[model samples]
Target chain A: MRAVLDEVRFLAFDVFGTVVDWRSSIARAAEPFLTGHGIEVDPLVFADEWRSRYQPSMEAVRTGVRPWVPLERLNRESLETVLARHGVDFGAVTGDELAELNRAWTRLDPWPDSVVGLTRLQRRFPIGPLSNGSIAGMLALARFGGLPWNVILGAEIAHNYKPMPQTYLRSVEAVGLRPDQVAMVAAHNADLRAARAVGLRTVFVARPLEFGPGQTADLTAEDDWDLVTGSITEVADLLGC
Target chain B: MRAVLDEVRFLAFDVFGTVVDWRSSIARAAEPFLTGHGIEVDPLVFADEWRSRYQPSMEAVRTGVRPWVPLERLNRESLETVLARHGVDFGAVTGDELAELNRAWTRLDPWPDSVVGLTRLQRRFPIGPLSNGSIAGMLALARFGGLPWNVILGAEIAHNYKPMPQTYLRSVEAVGLRPDQVAMVAAHNADLRAARAVGLRTVFVARPLEFGPGQTADLTAEDDWDLVTGSITEVADLLGC
Candidate 1:
């Protein structure tokens, strides 16, 4: 473990539910906007529905069924779908207003330990996002949440979503490092599994509350990851930062 | 000018001579290495010769004479050319040593006002480098120099060098902003002109010492840029940061 730690030169993180509390943050931003539009659905449910579309949407691009599209566009399209399913009159909302509401993804709040933990980790390694988020969205989220990333990597730059081998390989190459020299830190076993498959060292940080109460998935590390910890701060400690 | 500033949503900068004191930094790094190799040459002159190859080397790619290559590769090739011209024996250096020395470009020092001024500017805008430097090189330079950029943009991501339209246009698009809504901050008049020609608002920050005491160009703004300032701090003040 110490030898592997010694080889890690850069760290890239999964952003959405890992670094940021996207469920509550999206729910929080959706509440007022939905209420303003005379929509009566629970905002958390709305957030879930919006997020539930995330993987399937990317799967379309990953399978080459659809051309490459930015995650921002995917989020907005999913927003409209969720609104229509809730029986909201989409014609009443201005395009500008819809665009503003779709930007909620960029306003996510970080996990309590994210800023300080990443800052400490950054002293040892250059850190950035390795999520499916677009670079534009990542930039806004970094500013909104005070993420101490020195560079923004992954998705849009790779022109592919995560779980695709290219996403991990391309991002690692972008920083001029071999995969073994880079670590993928995430809350999901599947994300780490995919990264590890591509020669990237994997650290699984638990985010049990990412989906709120009754959350069942990703509650614990599903495999013997390189480092499995209860929080980003724990990951930092384990990495000797 | 005020209207243009109001519309600017992101700021991309030229890294080489705009943000860092590259000539002196390269010279400082080269002095010890060259002396150890028994090479009799002024380090600054070596730096100048290395930089002089930058444009012509990139022009090959810009004109499609060679397939795309990262700036790191270009820098190493230029280093070899400079060393051979000065009569250094190629057999003396190991590959690992050459690779380490080639990274001097990543170890540049920022100007006195850069860190503080950029920190202030970052408080208002999403700032990044839109240089010919590769993503790996830019990441290293940002870490080494303590640059307060929220994202790393430009060349490697765009797959083209500067003075090329796609470099500016693609970088702007990556951040989800139009050309008019992005500002190109640079010290070289030719670079600003290239950016402005592509509809990006231009700001010229003077770096008279970028080429050292005998600097003969870009000492003053050569055109009507959106903002022309003596320092990055002046740019921050003018932008109301």
Candidate 2:
């Protein structure tokens, strides 16, 4: 067992790229939608554009420009904007169809090591996702990907999005553990930095392909996190699971 | 699959009696403490009294007489009150010891059919506990009993107790489903009634021995629930899981 994890009672994860291959999954789901609409756009570019809207939308909540709505609503608004910007005709889509497509965030496929690693880690400590994704969205994603999170926590419960102090603080408190007793395992260095700033131990896992072949942002850790690994399974091994 | 369940995407459960045998579990844990303190009270009776305080304490939150606090704190306060009434000397116990004893709720054993039944049900629909237990308390109990809940909801999320409209409403909403799309499966008629009143469908499972040999309350369904069964396993069967 690593001495660092000796006091850790819970291992909280960042869901999007850390647990699920969001880019690829989103691209795959959007391809048929784009092709059926006769849009001459690469599905990967569409996925990138849709995901780029995530931060600005969440920023509206963090900055109090919007009230706390579940990420599902924000996701839909962002999706609609992206579709219109990309010249895709969503006029053919019913509200129900648009809503179903907005749930693409909940239909992600997990990175290969996520499920097995999380299962191993769960045997020794409570494991859960601390995503900016709404509790409902995470639950749907878990059901879809077989992610074994012990409890759902984060934005939905905190009423605040990620990189905000409340999101990390509230999640740790929800798990009934102090910040020092819970480790935040995330693929993004900025996320790890935010978590560490609030006294949580941070583990950095690399997902070079998280943003696809032309990925630029978060290509590698910007700082030395408490534990840096190539895969979540390595995280399990380090935790002595 | 039952046609009635065609729209239902989730089944939220009541944890204490409906999922775990809390009465027996509490009694078993308290017996040693009572015996060590030279108390003459029947442990089962003590368990009943402790459980009886549950609602009133929760009512304080529901009625806003008390600010939102986790059930674990309420449980400890209730335990101390019961201990004093029975003349159990706390002078012999340490603060740490009392806190440890307070977690008896987290150490509960599931009813024999709970794990198997929930496992089966989970294959078809997402299942979770919608208990007034604090999120931390429920998570610990789930780990202990090997209960498989897809998400954690209820009191911790709603910051309100059972029979309170928000508790049921928020749970259904938290599952990312409309009230009509999530069925509340419980052992108590009152719980089901509360759930149904909030537009959630209901399932009542009989647990005649929940309070041990002298159990009287909830011996049979008091109201017509959407589905009534004898065990959690039967609930799975009826749901075609």
Candidate 3:
């Protein structure tokens, strides 16, 4: 592990669950949106329904069932379905309002330790997101959450979604670093698995409550990831940052 | 001017001669390499010769004479020619050494006003480079000079060199901004001209010493750019940042 840490030059992050609390953030944003439209629906359930569509939407692009589209488009499309499920009339919501509500993903709040941990790690390495988020969406999220990044790296930059080899390889290539020289930091075992499969070092940080109090998966390291900790700050400490 | 400012949500910069003083930076990097290699050459002249090839090399890709390539590749190829001109045998230099020296562009020094001005402007808007440099190169430059940027934008992200409509338009699109909502800032009139043609607002900051004391071109604004100033600090002031 020491030897591996010695060779790592950059760190790429999984943004959604690892760094930011998207479930509650989305629920918070959805509550106001639902009330404004005179609709009655559980905001948390709405958030879950909207998020449940995320993977299927990306799978369409990954499987070549559809052309590449930014996550913003996918989010908007999923939002319509979520709203329709509550028997809400789409015409009641203005385009501008929908766009603003869709941006709830961008306005997500960072985990308590994310900023401090990232800031500490950044002192030793260049850090950026390597998520499925588009560059624009990541940029907005960074601004909203005050994520101190040295660069933006991710799916949009590679024109592919996460778990794809292109997303991992192209992002590594963009920073002029080999896969071994970069570390993919995430809270999900599957994300680390995909990154490790591509020769990138992987660090798993526990995001047990990411899906809420009833979360049943990804509560602990699932395999021999490069590093595993309870929070990003713990990861930073282990890295001597 | 106020109307233009109100519309501008982001600011993109021309980096080489505008944000960073590439002439002296390249010359400084060249001096040590030449001395270490037991070669005799005027560093500044070598810098000028290398820069002279920049446009022509980019022109190849822009005109379809060659496929798209990063500025780092172009700089390296140009470096080989410059070294050969100075009677240095390519075989004598190690590949690693050549790569380190080619990264001279990444270690450029920012103009005196750049950091302060950019920090001020960044408080009000997201700022980034829209130069022809690769994302890795721009990332290094930002780290080297401590440039405060919300995102890294430019040629590599767009996969096209500047002065091309795709370069400007794609960068704007990546930030989810329209042409009118972004300002292209530079020291070169040609860069501003190209940007303005694409409907982006332009801000010209004087860089009379960019080519040293004898500089005769771009000493002053060549046309009515959206805003013109002696330094980025003044531009920040004008924008009420």
Interface RMSD of each: 0.9, 0.9, 0.9
The sequence of per-residue lDDT tens digits that candidate 2 reaches over residues A1-241 is: 5577678888999999999999888888888778877878898888989999988889889988888998889889999998888676667877877777777888999999999999998888888889999888998899899998889988998999999999999989887889989999999998999999998998999999998988887877799788888899999988778
State the lDDT of candidate 1 residue by residue for A1-241, as single tens digits. Answer: 5677678999999999899999998899989988999998899988999999988879999988888999999989988988898898878988998898899999999999999999999987899999899998999899898898989899887888999999999999999999999999999999999999999998999999999897999999998888988888988888888
List, residue by residue over B1-241, the lDDT tens digit for candidate 1. Answer: 4787789999999989989999999999999899999888899998999999999989988887888899999999999998888888888888888788899999999998898989999998989999999989999999898998888888887788889999999999889899999999999999999999999999999999998899999999999999999889898989888
The clash numbers for all candidates, in the given order, read: 0, 0, 0
| Steric clash count of candidate 1 | 0
Candidate 1: list runs displaced more than 4 Å: none
DockQ, every prediction: 0.86, 0.77, 0.74
CAPRI-wise, candidate 1 is high
Give the alpha-carbon lDDT of every model: 0.91, 0.89, 0.90
Compose the digit string of candidate 3's lDDT tens values, residues B1-241. Answer: 4676688989999999999999999999989998998877678877889998999889988877788899999999999988888788878899999999998988999999999999999888888889899888888888899898778888888778889999999999999999999999999999999999999999999999988887899999999888999888998999988
Candidate No. with top lDDT: 1
User: Candidate 3 local accuracy as lDDT?
Assistant: 0.90
What C-alpha lDDT does candidate 1 achieve relative to the native structure? 0.91
| Candidate 3: residue pairs that collide | none
lDDT digits (tens) for residues A84-126 of candidate 3 = 8889887777899999999899999999999999999988788
Residue B32: error of model 3 in Å? 2.2
Worst 10 residues of 1 chain B by lDDT: B1-10
